[model samples]
Target chain A: SQQGEEDPQALSIQEGENATMNCSYKTSINNLQWYRQNSGRGLVHLILIRSNEREKHSGRLRVTLDTSKKSSSLLITASRAADTASYFCATERGGGTSYGKLTFGQGTILTVHP
Target chain B: EPEVTQTPSHQVTQMGQEVILRCVPISNHLYFYWYRQILGQKVEFLVSFYNNEISEKSEIFDDQFSVERPDGSNFTLKIRSTKLEDSAMYFCASSGGFEKLFFGSGTQLSVL
Candidate 1:
């Protein structure tokens, strides 16, 4: 029972194409963050978008959040083979004094072909 | 960039045995957390520690599991008695701020 469920559980794309993955959450959130996990590696922090913000950009990645719909999308532009990894969306549960205990989604497995 | 580090890339133990997973969070980070991911499942929060005390814990973090920062630089998670269900990848993380967190490579626990 994950709070955030990512759509398109698996995505495969060729190099240089844009990949878009969407995530939907059940409860309110203080913020939503994206992470990338290479096989047998740690989760790398990608980006964090606060509840008040609608969209954010970093490097070739762009994230859009729609609070009303309780959904978010991560867009990776010009995806490279190196970008192939599992992408997860984590939401810091709102209305708490907790110091960022994030609830992560099942993650979308992205496969980029060179 | 400073990153969180974990020891014993993999640990195998018999059911009912005790195991302690070790982690060294970024030196300056004050907030630390433990999370686990079962095979094919999402990452689940287990506990959060700050100011030398446990700030929050999840239902999954039962009486069998505990966390401590015995020293200034290291954080540890102790499972008094591990079960087969406890087999999972345990991740240690730290954050200087609540917005972004750095995670360790994770210790893969296999309970037999």
Candidate 2:
């Protein structure tokens, strides 16, 4: 089952623009992670933000998590044509056999025009 | 960077026929998992395995589905009787820890 719902099902922008996608999830989570999937390919782990951490960054990607609102956002700085892909937010619920299972969001599809 | 590897990039089988999907997780990773994504849908978790036993599974994983760590490196998901709805892209993943996961390219199963 899906635990999170991403807003803006699709987005189109030119290169060099920043793209932001939001995700809202139900239930408390130990961590929220973002992944990227190229068309017809596997998912690539992008970043992970623990429940205690508000924000985290890796390279051009930034992720923010807010447990209070049960929401999170992913930001791609200086987006490029190569950054065009589907982004998904996955949550790992806290405790009780939730260990390695991840519930993913519907995903946001971003198209970067070069 | 080691990766999780899945075999038979694409499989076509008739409904009611049994199918087996194979995966080889990173050598050092202890946790293994199976997930499926139907075309144009969210990725759904199927099962997770650790210490040679199933740690958790979703309701979607009925009696028809079974997982096996047949050897030290190979993990397999077997569907006893495939249904038309069983068609989807199945991904195998592994994690050394509980947070970050490495996913395989996936196997696209088509049950006709």
Candidate 3:
């Protein structure tokens, strides 16, 4: 079964605008994390919000997690053309030798037009 | 500024052939992982290795697949007999006992 499912499938925005992506997952989780992948590039870690934490931020990225609903959201403020990429949500299952293993979502393709 | 590094940005092999995708994880990290993504598909986990043994693996990690940490620095994933369905971008990632992972650029494998 797929653990993470992202909403909207795709998002588009203009420079200086804000883009938001939502993710829902099944199974109990230890933490939820966000990653970005540029065309033909590797996944880059963005931010991590623990199950206990409600919200966290880094630079222009803000992440919020609601464990009760098993959902998370990533908001990129003041978006730029450089922010065009695929955004994925990943989860670390709560039980049994996780070793930081992550299950990734299909991802939301975000295009920022300048 | 450390990062996971993978070799052979692209690999093309015939079906039933053996293939080895290599990775060099960060020196201080203790865990390594292999994930793959088919064109237009979600990234899927294959296996995770720690302390020279596999800590966890997915159903996709069948008998034909294997992972190794031959030395202190290099981690590798080997497919004994490749299948046409195995064509995908294989990614190598590592973590220093944390949830935030560092991933390599990936090896695009094509099995024909």
DockQ, each predicted model: 0.86, 0.90, 0.90
Q: Per-residue alpha-carbon lDDT of model 2 for A35-106, expressed as tens digits? A: 999999999999999999999999999999999999999999999999999999999985766787899999
B3-83: candidate 3 lDDT, tens digit per residue: 899999999999999999999999999989999999999999899888888999999999999999998899999999999
lDDT score at residue A94, model 1, on the 0-100 scale: 56
Model 2: number of backbone collisions: 0
Which residue runs of candidate 1 sit more than 4 Å off their true CA positions?
A: none
DockQ of 3: 0.90
Candidate 2 segments exceeding 4 Å error: none
Q: Write the per-residue lDDT of candidate 3 for residues A16-88, one digit (tens) a residue.
A: 9999999999898899999999999999999999889999999999999999999999999999999999999
For model 1, residues A1-114, the per-residue Cα lDDT tens digits are 558899899999999999999999989889999999999899999999999999999999999999999999999999999999999999987565466789899999999999
lDDT of each: 0.94, 0.94, 0.94
For candidate 2, give the docking quality class from DockQ.
Answer: high
List model 2 lDDT by residue over B27-84, tens digit each. 9999899999999888999999999989999999999999999999999999999999
For model 3, the stretches where C-alpha displacement exceeds 4 angstroms are: none
